[model samples]
Target: MHMGKSYQVSAKVDEGMLASALGSGDVGVLATPVMLSLMEQAACACVQDCLKEGETTVGAQIDLAHISAVPAGMEITATAEIIKIEGKKVLFKIFCEDREGIVGKGTHLRLIVNRDKFQQRAAAKVK
Candidate 1:
């Protein structure tokens, strides 16, 4: 994928996405894990159209910070931009926000892999 390519996705905070429900913390605000997942989703969408057949990306690393608490029912957006690509590794700059302002920001890494080969590797672990 080309550098500077980006994608954005939006979601409404729900009870199931709360920190308390996700077991990330005791508070009822949006969970950090959920925000990270959304960021990953945006990153995936950013490069999906550019992938070759049978190729998919898997998250390899994330360095993110949750800066504010978002209560349930609020809408939030996650945006991911492709900042760098090195061989099969892709780096992204990610940010999340609500109507108020930015609530999270950081970087993420994903590795492009053959879907069947990756699944075979994963399946081998159970054997």
Candidate 2:
């Protein structure tokens, strides 16, 4: 995948995405985990068209900071840029923003993997 590739994904915060509903916290605001999931979605979109069939990227690490709380009903956008690629690992710089301004920022790492192989390994664990 080419460096500097970027993608953006957005979602409207709802009750199901709230920190209180997610059990991450007791506040009636957007959850940190939801923000992280959006960031991961943007990152995946950045490289999705480049992946071969049966290949996918799995999140490996996330170093993010939720700087501000977003209340439900606000629209949030997450943007990710491919900053580095090393072997099978890809690094992305990501950030989340609301109508006011940036709400979170951080880096995330994902590793390219064969989907069937990864699923097979995961299934084996239950057997």
Candidate 3:
């Protein structure tokens, strides 16, 4: 099994967007900035899918740029590919596109962690 794999994620882009230069005021269909979230989630899933026996996955870092402002009600798709693997740590590259063109790109890192201990440590971080 390999950690650096690829996956396709479907998305809904917003429509009717406008730039700040236009004072009249029309805003693009605001979305939850799905690209970043999708990229991270895909990396996590890939790490989990490729984990060997007794291994678990956890997200470590994600560097992404949301380049395009998609209007409300449009559709988009983001693709993620794992680029490197170091033992329990995996690196991925993600790209996103909508009807207009490329919207975002970035690299992400995920680490295989002990499930029980990971959860405990995460819960403790919430001060």
Candidate 4:
């Protein structure tokens, strides 16, 4: 796969469910999943971008830093860029910016493999 490719992704949060006093939530913990979803999307898109050139590494892991908070109703966007390559493994630098500000930033690691087989192996590992 070719290097230096980038991908963009976005998501909006529902403010009503993010309030601290609401029966189901706490603000800090609530937005974490939103940031994670963006990261996952960005990482996946980056992998797809790489595949356009040729079959390349896929996401194996992610290291994320949630530095800012996003209230409900705000949208978050993530951009992932390929930074390095090691054989079948790829390294990406991910940044997430939202209506509030930079909500999260991270480094993601990916490795390539047959998709269907990967899922089967992953399921077996859980058991």
For this target, which candidate reaches the highest TM-score against the unseen true structure?
1
Candidate 2 lDDT, tens digit per residue, 67-116?
99999999999999999999999999999999999999999999999999
TM-score of 1: 0.97
Tens digits of per-residue lDDT for model 4, 1-127: 4577888987676654353635444653335655666776777777774463334445578888878766666776889888888877788888889766777888888887766666787799877
Error of 4 at 123 (Å): 4.1
Give per-model TM-scores.
Answer: 0.97, 0.96, 0.74, 0.75
Best lDDT among the predictions, by candidate number? 1
Give lDDT tens digits, candidate 3, residues 45-82: 65566666666876788787768776756777777787
Alpha carbon RMSD to native, model 2: 0.8
Q: Rank the candidates by lDDT, best first.
A: 1, 2, 4, 3
What RMSD, rounded to one decimal, does every model reach? Answer: 0.7, 0.8, 5.1, 3.8
Question: How many residue pairs collide in each prediction?
Answer: 0, 0, 8, 4
Off by over 4 Å in 1: none
Assess candidate 4 and give its TM-score to the true structure: 0.75
Q: What is the lDDT of residue 92 in candidate 4?
A: 86
* lDDT values for all models: 0.97, 0.96, 0.68, 0.71
Q: After superposition, how far is residue 83 of candidate 3 from its true place, in Å?
A: 0.5
